[model samples]
Target chain A: MIPLIQAAIVAVFLGTWQMLSPALGLQFFFATPLAVFQSLWALMKSGLLFYHAGITSLEAVAGFLLGGTLGMGIGILLGRHQLLAKVLAPFLTAIYSLPKAALAPLFILWFGIGIDMKIFLAGSIVFFLVFLNTFHGVREVSHEQIAILRLMKANERHLLTKVIIPSAIVWVFAGLRLSVPYALIGAILGEIIAANRGLGFLISSAAGRFDTAGTFAALIAIMFLALVLNRAITFAEGRLMPWRAAEEGREVPI
Target chain B: MPGPTAPPSRKSSEALPLIEFRNVGKTFARGALEAVRDVNLSVAPGEFLTLVGPSGCGKSTLLNMTAGLFLPTTGEVRYAGAVVADINVRVGYMTQVDHLLPWRTLAGNIAVPLEIAGRPKREIAAEVERLMTLVGLTGFGASYPSQLSGGMRKRAALARLFAYDPETLLMDEPFAALDAQMRLVLQVELKRLCRLLGKTVLFVTHDVDEAVALGDRCIVFTSRPGRVRQAITVDLPGDRDLRVLRYDPAYLAQCGALWRLLTPPVEPAVAPQGRRE
Candidate 1:
């Protein structure tokens, strides 16, 4: 039923765009759905679609992995150490508040206009998201729960492995899920600013050529990629935390 | 027999108290709130001593001191002849809420202590299985805490507590959240388990009935800055059924006595400030 509603919403949006395009002479600025699909089909047939999408997907996935792991590690570290967390809190807040997209240009200059630059861009953005969530996740673990493990003669290692890490995984997953789009955005923005490949390059180059349909097609591809990635995270979360899944299942009656 | 029978030292009179609070006092929020004051108490080995008091009365504070979650602001809590200055691993502390890791299955949660203790895989598995059966959770070992009923979660928490077989159990209203029937059932179950295993218990609850039902001796604490107002030995047989005992006239009289001690006086008490919390 939700899928049907989503389909209807998409159809209505396309219908509106298609109807308003020629009427308003908006084809150059906002291409009709038919034109976008035709360009998408042309790109697919020529294999350019896969090339650009693959590059973007690689950048996003790589960035997500690199940033997610680093973020989670540091988050756990800070979460466990009160003094260190206190020392770094202000600096983290300052850096986190800055618009991550603004760092793309700096990353391009620092890492060059290669996939490295895009990966760094995406990874840096993802890092803070995962780190903040993981930190809070680790920090917010009920002291009672930790105390329970402590009373069992659990050492620091035991507490971390058995309770802290597993408890924080829930938050880590949440942060990862949230950062999926941001990761793509970071990669794509870097590619647009300076890159020969990726969906962002395709979108920017098409727009520069005034090929509105091509740009729209690239955007549609990004939307699909984000959707798939988000779904993958949700699936992983269910697999890792069966208890959380059970909780959600129980909530369905209400 | 019906009155509050003050026994100076009931069980294990010949042996030194397994746990002793030597003039223990605790103040919180930088001495703003006096939670417990000058508490001098002792519990014998294998004794099921229950502490009953009103809210904010610091009954739980004493348990915390014993568990070494924290120290008394003044004086010391001695466990096994040594002052508790660190996280007391020889005792298992169970709070009101079931602290079963929601990420782990019932079997997995129960296996936590054993795993932490580095018991062999087979041994941990067997112990988990045994605990599940002991707590009537045999078929639900695979279930998550969220998947289980409140009663079941409590049982899982209890199982987890017993996994390491801690010498002493510090329980703070561990069954207060359950329904009346479930609470009674768990009370009986806990009493039975503690007896069978010979675990010294320091159970804290506000319920006078629960204190009477479970304890070898019940300590009634005065409201906030909780001092021990009375100590009454519950002479009920160890193996008695709680269901039958609840109706026994002697049980009723004991509950009444504890209730009186727990309740603040009607007229006095600093003009009864803003309800009994």
Candidate 2:
């Protein structure tokens, strides 16, 4: 029902856009949704859309994996060890708050329009998001639970694997959910600034040629990919964390 | 009226006291304030001992030391003749809150200690099953801790403790969160299980009746910067049920004595320390 209502609202907005673009004598610079869809159809038929999408997807996936792994590892370490957390917290926080887009030019300068620059740019953005959330998650685990683990004579490794990791998993997943979009944004932004191939390049090139329909087509494709990735995250979260789902179910009675 | 039919054995003599706290003093310097004063207690083999006192009395702190979660500032806590430096795997500590890992299923939570101990797969499975049955959690093993009721979660916590086969059990208000009926049921089950396994049990509670009902020997302590007020040995009928013991006059007297020891003394009203009105 909610989706249906949303779709109706979107349709109305698109119809208004279609009517206003030509009525206001706006140049082809502002494409209607129909025109965007038509151009997307053309791109799809030419098979270039999938190729660019594949490149973008690879960068996004690689960035997400690298960022997620590094974030979780460092987060858990900082969370578990008080000395390291205390020592590195200020530095990490400073770096985390910096504008990620500003760093892209530097990355591009160093890596020179290659996949490494895009991957690193996206990875860095996603890394901090996951790291901070995971660190908080691990730190927030109850002292009482730690006491229990200790009393059970759990060694350091067992404590980390069984108690610490499982305890932080919900937070990790939360970080993952928030980081996925950042990953896509980073990749697209990196591509826009420097790349010759990717959805970002496609959009930039279309804009340069005043091909509003092609730009809009790229935008729609990005949105579709983002939605798909978000759903995948939700599905994975449901599978990995049935307990959280059960808790939510209990909160609101049917 | 009769003892067990099994013949007595020399092995009983070798059963050492599971836990012994001698002149144990734990003082938390809240800048300068002390939290627990001099205290001494011993938990005999197969005995149920309870530390009961008012809020802020450091009972939980005392239990933490016993579990080797914390070290006493000025005394020793020994388990099976060895001084406790770290947590003893031979001891099981149940906290006031169940603290069952929310992410794990009941069985998974119960299997935690076994998992930590690196038990074999077959052993972990069998032990979890046995503990579930023992705690009346047979069918609820697959359910997450959040899915269970408060009483059920407490039971699962107990099962988790038992699964580790710890010779000594340290409980810090393990049933304090449960409803009255649930508390009673668990208390009875705990007592029965302790006797059956001959495990040394040191349980802490603020409730007078619960302490009296469960403890073979009850140790009462004073309020903050706590000290032992009295140690009373309860010699109730060996086979008497907990339900029946509630009505027994001796039990009531013990409860009254414990209540008297726990109540704070009334002080005479006087002028303010630094101001005069």
Which has the greatest DockQ? 1
Candidate 2 segments exceeding 4 Å error: A89-98, A102-112, A251-254, B1-18, B22-34, B73-85, B176-189, B237-243, B246-249, B259-277
What root-mean-square deviation over C-alphas does model 1 reach?
4.9
Each candidate's DockQ score against the native complex? 0.69, 0.64
Local accuracy of candidate 2 as per-residue lDDT tens digits, B61-145: 8778877777988888888789988777677888778989888889999988898888998999998998888767789888887
Off by over 4 Å in 1: A1-9, A90-106, A251-254, B1-14, B175-197, B206-210, B236-277
Q: Candidate 1 lDDT, tens digit per residue, B110-181?
A: 998888888999999998998888767888988878877777888788888877778789888888667787
lDDT of 1 at A254: 32
Interface RMSD for every prediction, one decimal?
0.9, 1.4
Candidate 2 collision pairs: none
Best by lDDT: 1
Which CAPRI level is candidate 2? Answer: medium
TM-score of each: 0.88, 0.87
